[model samples]
Target: MKTGIIGAMHEEILLLKKDIQRLKTEQFGSREFHSGTIDGKEVVMALSGWGKVAAASTATTLINHYQVDQLVFIGLAGSIQAQLHIGDIVVANQLIQHDVDLSRLEHFPEVKSPFWKDFSFKVLPQSEDKALQAVETFLANLKKGDYPAISKEYAPQVHLGAIGTGDQFIASKDGKMRINERFPQILCTEMEGAAIAQVGADYQIPCTVIRVISDKADEQAHDAFAEFLFENISNISVEIAKLIL
Candidate 1:
């Protein structure tokens, strides 16, 4: 099966690009698409840029142009749940767009919104199962000696839950509270996961999102995300991909 891998930022996919063998690169809508095999598994990789529109566009292009069978997204997120801290992994079983509330416009009578009923998109059950198992295998055999020194500080724990996506980077406690109040089940927040998941649903393609916690979604979130991005976090994606691919 051919898999299309997307990352929210260049750093999120940097190591992945290097791992692809016999890579063929091309430009689509000004974004580079790398087609190759990762450990003999057919794959295509691309940076999905930063927000809903960019991610959805990239996802649609990957589905229509590359004709990839399954999609896997790897990125960083801000933790909404107090128990979740930096380096923790979240495998999204479902995704929703927190920024898409249209209930206020219900009085328009002609306004149709998916959020009015149910906005969450479930990851394909079969693909979600495979991803969860892969994460388990990755975690079970992980050794500090096998990774960077920074990894020694915390052993990453996997959490399977719903993730909220929006164009805004949640940097305040009040913003976090408002989201949690509406989507009480959201484990983390990011800029692109749900948009890509929606595209997958539209195209009938299986999609899986894996996020590593980089911030607490609080006042200091910006600094946290920046620091975590420069660390050895990308290695986590590489190890998980090996098991999944």
Candidate 2:
């Protein structure tokens, strides 16, 4: 069972590539893909680049070229929920492109587009049952311990809920508030999860999205993200990868 693990940034993909024993590399679409074994499981990992289109294209390539049986996206996201804070982890149960509004986008005439032909602004579904079960097991079976990058006071929590995606980074207060009102159950917001989910839906590929909270989706998000860009972000992601994959 070959798994395709994707990340949007170098930090997100580097450790996994390093962890792969007897790794081999191949370049595709200007991105390098590393293939090897992870915890005795055959896997291919790559940096999918940023945004919805890049993620979708990467997913398609992994499916077609690597023929990966399952897909996993591990990265950081901005927390939009009131209770969530830094170092918190979120296993996406659902994903939606909050920026997608077929009604509003379809009305544009000058710069014509066809991608929104029959699409709707609804929750993009993902095949995540087994992945969700694995996460539940991980949380339930955990022993008392402190996470390295996580603060003891915050006592990092695990959230399972919807993840919103869009090209624009959620920073301004109004941007964060609007998304919150649109998707009340959102656990976090990111740039690529929904697009990856959409490609999975097309190929019937099972997908699991895991995001660590890096900042609150507000005016200070960009600054906070810079201050808190944990160097070991890939560590938590790989830990979850081992358990789920």
Candidate 3:
């Protein structure tokens, strides 16, 4: 099976690009596509940049242009739940667009505005229990020693829960607290996961988002990102590859 991997930032895609051997590069809609093998599995990958529009367009292109059977969005997110710390991994069991509103429509009560009456979004069901179990099992066996080139402990604690997506970058403590109070079950917040999920659902392709916590919704988020990203991003990418490949 051919799998497509999408990451929204250069940092998230760097390791995957480096790991690609026998790569063939192509472009469609100004986006670069790298097709290659990782762990003997056929893969096509791209960095979709930030935000909902960018993510949705890239996902569509991946499906139409590359003909991938499945997609995995891997990246970093800020923790909305206070207990979630940096380096923890979150596999979105479901995703929501906290910013979408269209309450005026009776049939789509989830939305809250007349303008958004025709803007209902899509949702990808959580991958089957066996797939999730396999991911968790691989994460459990990941070790820092296994990746000698990488520094810091590569321990990952996986949380399966709601992940909220929006176009805005979440760095405020007050905003984080407010969102947490409103969606208490949400585990993380990011800019692109839900958008990708919507496109995957439209195409009837299985999709899953695996994110590593790079911040905890505070000023320290900026201070900690460089360290957290450098130490854990590649390890997380490798873990995702192992699970699917």
Candidate 4:
């Protein structure tokens, strides 16, 4: 089966693009898709850009055009939880849009969305149990000898929980705290995961996101991003994909 891989930033998918064999490029609406095979699994890789619109648009194309059986996204996120540190992995069990306020629209859908845009029409998106299990399997056998970062006694942890997405970047302690209050289960915040999850849901495709924490989402967020934005955290996503495939 073909799998579509998307990353919000160039660095997120660069290594995977380099690893693809028999690559072919195709463009639609200015977005380019790199289609090929990753260790024998048919794959399509693309930069979905930042925010909800870009991610949703890219996801629609991948599902409709490539006929992919599943979708996977990997990108960087800022930590909302104090316990989370740089280089930690967050495997999304569910995704919601922290910025979408639909309290007023409750009568519209008559159902409920952890985010906006749904109730009667749609609901939040989630990774399949098997998807989480596959990722956990990969993590279980991981060795610190190869991944020196995790080799340390206080190595970063691989957490699985809800991920919150919004178009706006969270860079203040207050903003981070507010979201934490709203979505008490949120592990990380980023720009695109929820949108992709929604699109996958609309098309009945399974979706999964693997995020690496690169910042604290605090006043120092700007500095933290500048320091680690291009450090290729997307490698974690690719490794997870390789194991699952």
The lDDT values for all models are 0.88, 0.78, 0.76, 0.79
Please, what are the lDDT tens digits per residue for candidate 2 over residues 1-245? 89998999877756767778889999987888899897799898889889999999989999999999988898899998889888787888788888877667546766566444432222224446656666555555443343455333433587878888999898877888898887787778999988988887778787778888988888789777876665546666666676776
- Report the number of backbone clashes for model 2: 1
Q: Number of clashing pairs, model 3?
A: 8
Q: What residue pairs are clashing in model 3?
A: 101-112, 101-113, 102-111, 102-112, 102-113, 103-111, 103-112, 103-113
Cα lDDT, model 2, residue 45: 87
Candidate 3 regions with alpha-carbon error over 4 angstroms = 104-131
Residue-by-residue lDDT tens digits, candidate 3, 134-208: 567765555524455545455657787888888877778987887777678788889898888777777888777
Look at candidate 2 and tell me the lDDT of residue 212: 82
Candidate 4, residues 157-186, lDDT tens digits: the string is 778788899998999999999999988889
How far is 218's C-alpha from truth in model 1 (Å)?
A: 0.4
- After TM-score superposition, the amount by which residue 33's alpha carbon in candidate 4 deviates from its true location, in angstroms, is 0.4
lDDT over C-alpha atoms for residue 168 of model 3: 78
lDDT of 1 by residue, 50-113 (tens): 9999999999999999999999998899999998989999999999999888677768978666
TM-score of 1: 0.94
Candidate 2: pairs in clash: 171-218
- Rank by TM-score (best first): 1, 3, 4, 2
Better of 2 and 3 by TM-score: 3
